[model samples]
Target: MDSSPDMGLFGPESVTWKVHSEPIVTMGGLRSLYLQALHPRAVAAIAQNSGYKSDPWGRFNRTSEYVGTVLYGSTDEVERIASRIRRMHSRMTATDPRTGERFRIDEPELLRWVHVAEVESFLSTARRAGLKLTDAEVDTYYTEQLKAAELVGLDPATVPGTAAEVAAYYERMRPQLGITREAAETALFLTVPPLPDFWGNRALRLSLNFGPARWAYFGVAGTAVALLPPWARKMYGGLGLPTTDLSADLSVRGMRLLLAGLLAAAPEQYKMAPMRRAALERAGLA
Candidate 1:
């Protein structure tokens, strides 16, 4: 890839506009991120509610039951259902933990990972479910995602190209992305709350920091996930905790909103192998 541009992976395009303009198969890119980044525990809850047994990959990996049919189904049908999910979630908004400000569901940074994760998930879970998507199809999905990652501030080289590779990368990077009480509170408040059936003492603390408002929202569930050490966090990353570029801006609430957007947008490329390879092709970052 070219090293001339310093805009990270983006090529001088606005992410919000790009998302709207892009021919993303389902729900454009933002919806993809929501599905990709939906917490594993939350996914597990949904799975249990639906009576689907989650694999070792946890809740987000349960897409074999939902996204699978779409990818393999008629193109028109896939587009219709995907569009509905987006329309419903479009009104869904979340708060910035640091600033208490509200933001839309499809923020810029979030859109990038969403685009990437969906492509990844499509390839990974589909294959696992015994469907065979050609390399050409997988590659086509990946090349499009590389553009999205660049727009979001990640170096194309930094993004993995394949679902399997991305999964491995996450396993490798997991230790550094440790989950602390502070991290948990920040992560939880930044996104929407999990279903009521999923909330508990442990889930409460893992959902937010210790405070009146936090307690009111999370109660004890956050505390449970918070009790987990770095190892557990490492496991969480594999289980669908996001691994994406986060903004470093501290004073602005919007930047924190961007972080929420990013986390909410994770699981870049649902299937890791193709996505990781494509990410490497972008900048040889692999």
Candidate 2:
């Protein structure tokens, strides 16, 4: 494997590096997926081509690995993964049931939606979770993530790179987005993913099979929903909340504290990506 002395993509000094290194961002992954599903064409493409429902964890793991690679891998590794994703998207297409029009998965609009949704979710979740990022740093984080947006075939110039820009982008996209049946179905699946029978631990499987897992899942699902923007929450018909922003804030803060505590107890090697670990070692920070 080729290693770079330079920090790949955003580098250690970048806000993206600081924010993404946190374990709490895992919640943003679910938020991003849920938000993306609300885009009818994106969800349609996913349903047609991906095994998301049957292998949600597998899909999520692969996506997480790719994101980690982009954030922490060598320059060549970053390009390699980005190129692979571009090739895959270029070969896939989905037809819109509403219009009967076939569109490529790499369509600029779809790519932009996925990119913006993910970046916005990440920043929003980190802030709500008490990550202590200043408004300027948050803007920097968004601007830094343009490199990631470009990885998914979006034009960086067209992507939003500030909080205000993101809000404007959502405003512009609101008319095109809604809670479709596919979105609703995907949301349900995300909230309560079925545990595989062959999960290799009988006791764990039994627990999930009974009720504990479902209860735990609902707690997480509720928090993920609470993290959604007010507009998105409304679109989902108040599944996450029917009350006040204060309640949502409190829930998110509590979840953040729980995640932070867990991360604190975990070993450094377990909490960080391998590339990040290596970078920290090299910098004498580990």
- Over 71-169, each residue of candidate 2 has an lDDT whose tens digit, in order, gives 888778899999999999899999885787999989999999998999888878877777889999989999999988888878899999998999999
Candidate 1 per-residue lDDT, tens place, 204-239, comes to 756544546555435223222222222443444532
Q: Quote the positional error of residue 64 for candidate 1 in Å.
A: 5.0
Q: Pairs clashing in candidate 2?
A: none
Clashes of each: 51, 0
Stretches of candidate 2 off by over 4 Å are 1-4, 196-198, 201-206, 239-243, 282-284
> In terms of TM-score, which candidate is strongest?
2
Give the distance in Å from residue 158's predicted Cα in candidate 1 to where it truly belongs.
Answer: 15
Indicate the worst ten consecutive residues by lDDT in candidate 1: 243-252
